[model samples]
Target: MDQKIIKVITGQRRVGKSYLLFQLIRLIQEREPAANIIYINKEDLEFSFIKTAEDLNKYVLANKVEGTKTYVFIDEIQDIENFGTALRSLLLKEDLDLYCTGSNANLLSGDIAGHLSGRYVEIEVYSLAYPEFLAFHKLAENNKSLDKYLKYGGLPYLIHLELEDEVVFEYLKNIYSSIVYRDIINRYSVRNTTFLEQLVLFLAAHTGSIFSAKKISDFLKSQRVNMAPNQVQTYIQHLVNAFLIHKVARYDLVGKRLFEIGEKYYFENLGIRNGLWGYRLEDRGKIMENVVYNHLLFKGYKVQVGILGNKEVDFIAEKDGEKLYVQVALTINNPDTLEREFGNLKNIPDNYPKKVVTMETFSGNTVEGIEAQDLRSFLLA
Candidate 1:
């Protein structure tokens, strides 16, 4: 289906959306060479002239390739204003299979669907899931190698081990800047981007932890960079829009309550976060949780950071009639640590398949009624 359809691929930055689009185009070209594939990257300086719908129509006419199934591939198309209408017009009048890639979900939300109703399909792509990451880096499926993927995530371009750590960090830094400057600042006309940058750093430093914007504002205030709670909230939304951070709301299944009090965030790739800040093994739990979050999302589950009773489940995945309770920890370690993790699953008082995944151990057994499984095995399975 990924290759058969001409669809819009939306995902976080550096998550292989562009590359995936290119791959699909190549596949289509191999099948139908006479099928014209005109690729236009909106960020290109040559396409800078495409600011309005008229410009787009002219640009399309100038570069029009002749074929029965001409594949029109556009990348980062949100840069062009009123592009939705132009695309709608082209799709309506022409016999073209359209493929577009965007950095975020704005294309789906902001008038694109309304303008091009039932005209296109959307496919979401994500950063390398655990299995993909392992395959990309040619790493053995073991605790030690999975640890490396967790520490520095699987951004396809950075899979090479020969690249210096500093070089990788610099690349991530450039990506961070692109999201901040191009996606947020340029797209939203946000003033005083310093607060936004600080907010992202704060969120990245404390991923997987649930806290309110007011609490974050208070924390920022203590650092002498006092900003309003509303401002902090806006900054967080901006980051989420740019796809650098994902805010997961706490779902209280027992109480049947959806509270806006505390929300958790996960980075698109742990490598970028670890690169920006000094890496630490102590932060492995959040890194693993981030990996799992991306995995469940790519697997087509509606996932949430679960708040059940007094314990927090790392992920609550639901699809169709199935529900999964997940707990992510660095290791099953000693009895006490094991109890803490397994206890969270043990107390659920429901049979929804509880799992405790970690970097250690290959044994799969029932610990205190909670199924304990190694992270690598889960991915491979």
Candidate 2:
């Protein structure tokens, strides 16, 4: 908390970065009522005149109170031209503490980092977690809440709207379009937007499935889109850089190796995924696995897909030397499904905690030394 370096909070748009900055401002106000603080939001029309670094510096200097320590908070710093220069100039003042938020990866692009001389700490923010979602909606943790969470996801605005399906869908659609246009297309100057849109839909539909760029290209070719594998790979990288989707690599549990090919991609928010597919429930199991992957990330675990011999464990979550093996399923009612989920965890040699998470209502059971837990209970825990 006492670090003097500039703090950069970054994430996808509308993921609560601005709100978090406001919360920090409130905290500072409560702690030090006399503290001098300067808040500027680039999205506001009042700051439209402050486009260049000199303009920004002049504005801050003109507003800042002398003979006092000042904290500066700028939202969407990337909107200002040569923002790094302004930040660097401000860093020279010993009394100024600087923090900023940006929505896209361009905030940390090569030239910007070079300009800043690596004098900043980055804090990446994500959407709300399942437990946070429950708290936001004032709902008890249960199957119904979990179902709603899985379908709509943890985007904060959805909670604010009370999860009305139509309104949430429209909001998510707009957010998706803004990300695609501003972050991906405009930033990368992508020409074939149709192909990019198709790639997004393809990835959204096949979330949690293993496929390479060549495979995706072949699938698109079969659909008559005809994109080269190299091009597909580049587009996918853009999506990842924009923080719209995440790539999860496969880990060989037996050999302790990381595989480069055939990794799975998960959307940053399930609500956006549903918005892409019109809220279809065609692949419930895969969606369940994706949700579990995201939930593990929210818990601050470094997660990977585990491959042991020929079997695959859904997640290998580790944090601070503690390890957990998890398998996610829509249900374990069928004997084969139960074995498939639990048997894979049993193959691990060590005595690390193993769990199988499912949508089953009843809990408190074990299969082959692996705990079988309902998804709601697992998420809440």
Candidate 3:
């Protein structure tokens, strides 16, 4: 609760970053009832005057109590100009426990990292994981719940909305617009809004598919949107920085190196993807793959696409110096489907927990030592 380093809680816009800050504030209040807490939310119009570093410092210092640890909480700190300078100054005070939330990942990767360096630790918040989704919706763990999860995705705010396509998708679409307009376009000063939206749509449509910037650019060109490969790359990076989508590099199983040319893009929230790009039965395989990737990430794994010669493994998740190979499929009902999903993981020589996840339920069966788990079981576990 009381740390000298700045706790930077970052995520996409409206992913409950502010709610998390409130939770932290609640925890602190419970722990220290008489603590001095200074809270500033830039999104709130009341804090509009606190725009610059001087404004921030003056407000915090003015509210500071003598000989006591002040827990400072700032929401959307990126709204403040030269926020790193204010944070750097505030961090020096032994009694001030600095904590701030940001919606942009670039806030850490760019100048802030240069200013704060080792003085700050980033906590990346994501959309509700599968378990959290079930709990939030007050739904029992079942196929129907899973379907709702896959269809709507795990945006925490979805709890208040009715789980209807018209209701949920509309809300999700609005959230998507906010993220694109405010986080991506406004933050990066993106010029070609049309190209950016098209790119996002393309990524959503082709989620879990591996391709390069040149490939994307050429494809867009075919669609009459002529953007250079470099520009396409820049817009994609902007999306990634905004935490709208994650770019998973293709890892070579044999060479033990990552491939630079091709990478898979998965949306941070599936509802946003489904809202923007209509949810279809035909795209279930890719949707399942995206769900698996998000779950792996939710469980704190560093995931990548694995390339084993001619075959492809959906995910290579690693955490705590340990590795786990995962292959996602809609169903392994067919012999060929089963072989491809299991065979790819079996090809991995290292015996570090290889498994296949699918929508179909199995009786704890293992295909040549590779486990098969239903999507719900995998997500919950």
Best by TM-score: 3
Root-mean-square deviation per candidate: 2.5, 2.2, 1.1
lDDT of 3: 0.91
lDDT of 3 at 63: 99
TM-score of 1: 0.91
lDDT of each: 0.78, 0.86, 0.91
What's the C-alpha lDDT at position 255 in model 3?
Answer: 95
Clashing pairs in 3: none
Regions more than 4 Å wrong, model 2? 106-118
- What's each prediction's TM-score? 0.91, 0.92, 0.98
* lDDT of each residue in 69-98, candidate 1, tens digit only: 567788888877888877877776455667
Instruction: Tell me the lDDT of candidate 1.
Output: 0.78
Model 3 Cα lDDT, one tens digit per residue, 95-205: 999889988887998858989899888888888998999889889999899999999998888899899999999998998898888888887888899889999999988
Q: Give me candidate 3's TM-score against the actual structure.
A: 0.98
